[model samples]
Target: MRLFLVIFAVIIISGCDDSNSKPSTKLSEQQSSSLLTIKDESVIPETEFSIVFTPNNEVEIIDAYIEGVDMYMGRIPLFFSRTNKQLQYIASGMVGVCSKNEMVWRIYLHYRKNGTQEGKIATLNFVVTNT
Candidate 1:
């Protein structure tokens, strides 16, 4: 009889504690704006530039290139079957060059499941000066 009473008391206390817990609220716009914001007003150097692609699913990154530069092309096989969420890929070899001019780049992603084309092209302008 004592063990049964103790068990019942424990369950009742646990239920009461959970009922008294406050629900979580979403963050306000002002609070969240700066959390994930990117400030692009300031000019960044060309050598500091890179290309990024957010994939919608498990994808094999076929190639990333600076559009007109054939030598800049490269491939990467990515597996995201565990999660169909967004995944990011960054372009390589163009890290730090002082070339403050506009350039176009393309990132091509191949879905592993259906073999469909998921490509993205981005144009960025930044100043690059010889260091």
Candidate 2:
């Protein structure tokens, strides 16, 4: 009977252990930055640059694409990486080419927050210094 009692007590103790319980996801979740950064803001076409993306929140997946906003360049897919909370990429500069002195490119970002099926989109624009 004593052994049975001890077993029951152990079960009860384990059941009431809050220390092992996972914290609320909503509590730890906060909005992150959508637009990351480019090492050089004065971007030059066909030149590579270091870019980073910080999603608005933890995400399961993120996909990005770039296209010319001021000229004719079809949407081109881009690949990047997520380390901790930041996504890094070495962009192969702008594909936009036109008669204008400055070329404009728009990046469309799509992401799915961690533990969710709902998706989000962010739009960022940059100019190429046709120098």
Candidate 3:
């Protein structure tokens, strides 16, 4: 009975560990499929994050906004500047806060030369790391 209990506890602990450490972003074919890479793999709510854009064509970030998918977090504008050559887009401050453990946030990246009206929409449904 002791051995069985220990094994059960071990299994429960291991199962609680987060498996989705690396967040994945999905974009349609028209949106270039995979051009946006969130700097840090793990993202937290109401935190600043930089998005690195790697496009084949000449790109210019006009604007970027993030919205909560599962809930209504409102459309918040992310920070971005043409001069900031390093982080094309940056999001911070009152961005997202959810009641659940995981909240799906989507970023609508509006950039020039992305071959779409206004900008390409990318749904970044990622798991928010610990508080």
lDDT of 3 by residue, 1-131 (tens): 67545633433342222322245666645675436667775664435566655555656677676666766645666665442554344444233445555556666676666565556554454555434
- Candidate 3 TM-score to native: 0.60
Q: How far is 103's C-alpha from truth in model 1 (Å)?
A: 6.1
Candidate 1 segments whose C-alpha is farther than 4 A from its true place: 1-46, 68-86, 92-131
Off by over 4 Å in 3: 1-22, 82-94, 114-119, 129-131
TM-score, structure 1 vs. true: 0.30
Instruction: State the lDDT of candidate 1 residue by residue for 40-130, as single tens digits.
Output: 3222322222334443444564433232222222222222222233454454323222122332222233223236564432222222222
> If scored against the real structure, what TM-score would every candidate get?
0.30, 0.60, 0.60
Q: What is the full ranking by lDDT, best candidate first?
A: 3, 2, 1
In the range 42-93, model 2's lDDT, one tens digit per residue, is 4544445555566556665477776667664556566666655344334443
> Evaluated with lDDT, which candidate comes out highest?
3
The per-candidate count of clashes, in order, stands at: 8, 1, 0
Residue-level error in angstroms, candidate 2, position 37: 2.3
Candidate order, TM-score descending? 3, 2, 1
Which model, 1 or 2, shows the larger lDDT? Answer: 2
Worst 10 residues of 3 by lDDT: 12-21
RMSD of 3: 13.2
